[model samples]
Target: MSVATESVPVFAIAPAEDGQIAFPPAMEARFRPGLAAVHDEMLAREEVIALLCFGSAPRGEAKPKSDLDVLALTNGTEYWKRSRMINGVEVQLQVGPLQHWREDIEKGNPAMIDAFATGELLFDRTGEATALKRDAEERFRAGPAEPGPKFFQRQRYAITNIVLDLEDMAEDSLEARVLAGFMVLEALRFWCAAQRFWPNRKPWVMLRQLQGRDSSLGAKIESFYTSYSSVHAIAFTDAVLEGVGGRLYELSTDPEPVPS
Candidate 1:
């Protein structure tokens, strides 16, 4: 097989060595100057209200391939754009509507919220950025909810995708199961979130709950992850689907399955 797997995007944050993760002092100094310049330029725009950086670069584990996730929170359809070279990569800026941006913020969006809370602030005005951090933290404190229609839909789509990935991984090709597990946990977390139960964003947390509820099923999923095998993963996913049965729709739809 001559296929080339794309290098993981540096912007996608992953667990790394505790102290080894971070932007270098030189990179920070370099990026801030250009960011500050953009801030000064955009501050005069009436439509632009907030600006924030997202992705792994801010979390301090950026590699050479990270994108500078510049959020331009605007009031309306106002044009806001910027470009510069930073840390040897060409950086571009994005401007978005404030209401829409904040809505995602309220959804407890991990990337943006984590970046804002832990990210270095290049500029702040309108107090919205700070408010976003506050609101996100509060939502986290409020905890994860039950798997509503939206959550169910998302999970269904994810499970379908994972099934496909498992097939692919059987060929010794893709690591989609790793990503699939994350999606499954996300679905479970959202279901829990809808129920106002906050599970920490670690695999072990869900694994623990799964164990308490369905030890065999838990063992199956854990095995797939541990072995990183597609066959085991597919088998485990089948079990999950069977276990879900009529309750599956309840996670996303209205009709609870009538007992057979």
Candidate 2:
């Protein structure tokens, strides 16, 4: 479907008062042409309805190597993804139905909710993108559902197992180091869920968010990574367990049914 550039609404990257682009100067220089090309390609499709720019680039936290993430909302039932190196930056494009994204927001899919709530609207054909974004923002503000007891119980059980495995391995062994890394990540996920915050996929971003919530815990976590000290790792794990009702020795199970 042909769409006039004048007809599609632009929300985030509109021109400034001085006739300059609203995006960061460096980012605009690097990705503007690439984004325009992708936009043109997607908007040309009859099923494509809206386009959103999310992740690090739009958040202004993008590193030189960061990929530009774009989501194309489509009317079709199928999903599509493409990756292209444009202007030395990889553009990651995702195409899915509008209702799929809306359901994801309603279900508290952290990534989807984050995209809709914080992403830039590059193209909107029917104003549906705007409404979806508003809904995502509202849900984000309200916070995720309090993770039920079963969630905590499962985390506790798994972490206890990891700690046991760590105890069995030599501190300097490569296997120990790998397991310690997994433990650190799992602990962070557990901590974030306990606090009703979505755990970021990126390690640095997750640590930053964790630090925002609790600097002391963040420091402990960082210490393990910086020094790879078994003590520091234990301390971090202990802190996480303390927050989540301590180590799980015996998992609570459902009551057995009495036979007639």
Candidate 3:
């Protein structure tokens, strides 16, 4: 919310007929068994209260090799892994206990909320996911909430560290900078969301969304990732940093005032 000076738009996926979401053909072929497996897991136990599918799989941007992002809310007493692969497809779960959903919000993790805001609700036990998602959207419509000091601090800190990393990579040959290119892209993605731009959780999707926000910025980033393929790491880094040093500063520091 505070992270973006430009009004950040909320993205949501409306379900198709028959109440099922779509995936790319190859993705569905490979990923469905795993989703079904989760469905079975949820059905077999009362502890699993909800299942959600976000990112490329639900949005149908996935290619043959795409993985899934799932949020499974369970009654387990503790949180779980951030990611785990099933059937060779990596599933990035914000895997935590039921309380973690509330934590996701309170921590000012807007992307997590945007995931639910835009994602397809795969399973909702007695409408658990549906009800909570509506509440999340209400907050979204209320406008971007400032992610607060820690969120801003973390984003700025991470960016600072990455610049230092670029310095370290400079002494090395092309391969090192290539790796650094990836790191830069990641930083760019985080900065976008940290500024409340909210691209669904994928590199290309995020790139497109960035382009949507500013065509020149988008094309410049895409050109590097495409042409040099990170061979020109310094240029790539510079191009990426152009997105920073603007409204992000204002959004990160100037939160909406709290009434006493």
Q: Write the per-residue lDDT of candidate 3 for residues 155-254, one digit (tens) a residue.
A: 6556656555666664456866566676657666765665566445567667666777767666666666665544344454555555554213222445
Model 3 collision count:
2
Q: Which candidate is the best by lDDT?
A: 2
Instruction: Write down the lDDT that model 3 would get.
Output: 0.60
Residue 21 CA error for candidate 3 (Å)? 11
TM-score of 3: 0.58
Give one digit per residue, the lDDT tens place, for model 2 in 1-260. 11124433455333222322344333546777667678777766779877888887877778888888989998889988899999898999999999888888877798898888878877666777777887888877877789988888989998988988898989888888888888888888788888888657777777778899898998899899998866677789989999878999888868879998
Better of 2 and 3 by TM-score: 2
Q: Order of candidates by lDDT, top first? A: 2, 3, 1
> Residue by residue across 37-122, what tens digits does model 1's lDDT show?
55555555667666666555555555666556566677786555666676555567878776675666566665455545555434
What are the TM-scores, per candidate, against the unseen true structure?
A: 0.49, 0.84, 0.58
Candidate 1 stretches with Cα past 4 Å from truth are 1-37, 43-49, 74-84, 96-100, 103-120, 149-228, 235-260
| Per-model lDDT | 0.55, 0.79, 0.60
